[model samples]
Target: MDFQTDKASLKIIRNKKLEYELPFLWIRDNCSCNDCRIQETKEKRFMLNSIPADLKPKKISINEDALNVIWPDEHETIIRFQDLELLKKSRKPEKILWTNDFIPNNYDWSDFLTDDCVAIDAFSEFIAKGAICISNSPCILNSLEDLAPRLGPIREVLFERIHNVSVDGHIYNIAHTSLEVPPHNDFASYSWPPSVQALHMLENECDGGKSMIVDGYKVLSDLKNDHPEFFKILTTFSVPFREFDEENETFANEPIIRLNSSNEIIGLRYSNQLMQMIDPSKKNLDTFYKAYHELCKRVNDKKYKSTFRLEAGNILLVSAHRVLHGREEFKPSGKRHLQDAYYELDNIENNLVLYKELRGN
Candidate 1:
């Protein structure tokens, strides 16, 4: 193995064919030595202001089980090859895109209720596909509350922890009405929206009202590829979002499509019901409307949406970050009830990772 440096990157050349060019600044910024990072917690101790704009490594040497580097400031650091490889891989998750044709795996609730392997698998399905269908669970009240921690701590919103979904004559939320709910994410008005949602069906003897979902990532990807200008506008500008009632009034101004440092789509927050009025002077209304309408149309496009009938005792766990949920209009004749709750994605992911480790996978 050899550690080499080019004009702009730190090259790790294991052999003639195995090599990777990590940027010079990247290598320095990621230094995890005891001085650069806390030895006890392995957290970064150095601040960004401490690094020079044009700083580069002074020397690169292959030490035992690690690549040793001397910085321009005469500071020494070491990074293991294994750690670097892991860091590189963790820069982004392996992406999986889907549309109406995508059929997700179903995790049996019977197995998930008992077997740790099945529980881990169910969590993994939610993490990877952003949606999963859980079948054969008890159709009892507050049953979801009892098992909500299977993923993570129950995230509290203004709504009840274990919310009851039924068509009462309450005129507060549209969800309480027997009208068609548009495809959108919930709690978008919150600055930090709920990351995961578990909708467990207690009863559904309705005529219509199948559960519909749209992949926000796939819609954004198509927008970025086909309409680059609209995508750019969406990613750059923030829009007002608000949710209000007699009791709770939540608000936030965030972009419809959020991006990371590398300009990759990271998450989405959208809700037609909660979207507030945008200031015309702050943004070009004509141009913004064009982009906004296009995004909405794409999200609601039947070709990019999936509709399924949620039977009693089936739970639909979806990543609310990139999945928009909706429901069709149903006849108010038959009984229809559902119990729902929220959880954070990090909790399910942490559980999955730990389960994998304990299983030696």
Candidate 2:
């Protein structure tokens, strides 16, 4: 195998047949040497603009650990080939779809509290599948606050960082009332929705209050596969979601389905209760409703959703961006309290990387 570069690109040839090219500017900008980047902080000291517009490599050589590039300005920089190879494998694969046959897995809270590795594993499972249950946690207020640092800092929503989930009649939110909350993602109307949501069930002293969680990605996958026209309507049209408490009014317009440039499902915003009017002038009303009803039908189907009651001291964690969560109605006979909090995906992934680095995983 041989490596070669010129003004425009670098070429790597292997077995005399296979080859790859790396752009010279990209390689120069990514210099990992101490003079280009701080060794400890990993922050850049050299900017890409510092390279001349017509700059090219003076010479290229390979050492045991790095590829050395001598630039036209006589500046020597080194970049490890391993880093480039690692990037090839870093793109995330499409998420796996879960059917109703999905069995919920619970990680023991006691084990997590004792072992850092165990805690990391639990967070990782939640990140991958979008849902996880922490069983047999200490039944106490603010139990979620203890686990907040395990992944990242908890965020405060309209209700605050840790809101009590019960029917006291003080709050007008549907979640606080003993009503059958539909399968929906929380805070769909926000311009930037919270990526992580967690619920710690402290008490389940009533009858018939079960929790439901559906994989939004799975539902979208099914719709896109089965009804392409309906999927097209859902993805292309934006709808309104509004929330108003006597003191504040929040509203945002977003499509029920979010997609990437390649038209693959990337995010979802779904909340039937909070969704407001979609004016008929925007599209064909009859057609839109037909497609909308079909999507809702699939979401509500048992074959696409997972429902189970949470026991006291059980915590349900979800990546709210991809999973729809709801609750069943219960009698107001006794206390049914839960504490919920939200976090950003950045923080969760941030700590995930930190833990892997610390554990040398």
Candidate 3:
């Protein structure tokens, strides 16, 4: 490899067609020398403010595996070429969108909780598809806590840590009623709601109430393809949402669609039932409603929903940020109880990486 440098950056040429341009400031800021970093933790010690704005390398040396740079002050910095290549790669799995006919991958509950290989497979599928169902889970009430060893800690929210949904339980929300619940993620009222949810069915002797899920990201993609304007509006327009009981209350005003720095969709905060009334006098109210209408149509379309039934020992895990879960109306004749708890997707994804490393993958 050969390299050339200018005032702002260094250009490393691996071949006639392959090359990389790295900024000089970035390299200097990331100097891995003992003086620039803590020896024990390898945490950065040199602050960017301590350096000059246009600092350049006084000398540069390239070896087969690394690049060596000498600053004006004779401080040396070494960076591995392999590390630079690794920086361009990511471990996060690409999302695999699904349609109405999609069926969630099922895993045995015992294998999922105890085996690393099975956990890795299940977690990877969950990350890709945004949902998975585990069969033969413990049927006892409050058994959702047993998932802590695999799903990390339960995220406590208003009213309860683990929620019970039943016609006979606390009627704080529509989930307790026999009426049909539209596709939505829970706790959309929170600014940053939990990203992961596990609905553990303890009893389901009801005639109907088939579980339904919509890939909110898939709907957004379709909407973006059909009406980019509507997609843009939903991402930028903040809407009010709220959920409350007799004593507890929670509320937030956030965009229905969330994006990351790269303008990639990262979340969908959609809760139709919990959405509060907005003032008619607000700016762009008419335009926002039009966009919302288009979004709503696609979200509830039968072409986007996957329907199934939850048995007594089934646990449906959902990535709340990207998937919307709901239930069809059922008769109140027979008993039907489900317990749900919240967790963060980060921990579950990290656990997958750890398991992979342990298996020498």
Top candidate by TM-score: 3
Please tell me which model should have the higher lDDT, number 1 or number 3. Answer: 3
Using lDDT as the measure, which candidate wins? 3
What 10-residue stretch in candidate 1 is worst by lDDT?
Answer: 86-95
- Model 2 residue 39 lDDT score: 80
Per-model TM-score versus the true fold: 0.84, 0.91, 0.97
Query: Compared with the true structure, what per-residue lDDT tens digits does model 2 show for residues 110-208?
Result: 787678788677767766788888899999988888876675788776756687888874585798888988899878879678888888999999998
Which whole-number lDDT from 0 to 100 does residue 300 have in model 3?
A: 93
Provide the overall lDDT of each model, using Cα atoms, as 2-decimal numbers.
0.82, 0.81, 0.92
**Cα lDDT for residue 179, candidate 3:** 97
Residue clash pairs of candidate 3: none
Question: Least lDDT summed over 10 consecutive residues: which range in candidate 2?
Answer: 88-97
Candidate 3, overall lDDT? 0.92
Candidates 1 and 3, the one with greater TM-score = 3
| Clashing residue pairs, backbone N/CA/C < 3 A, model 1 | none
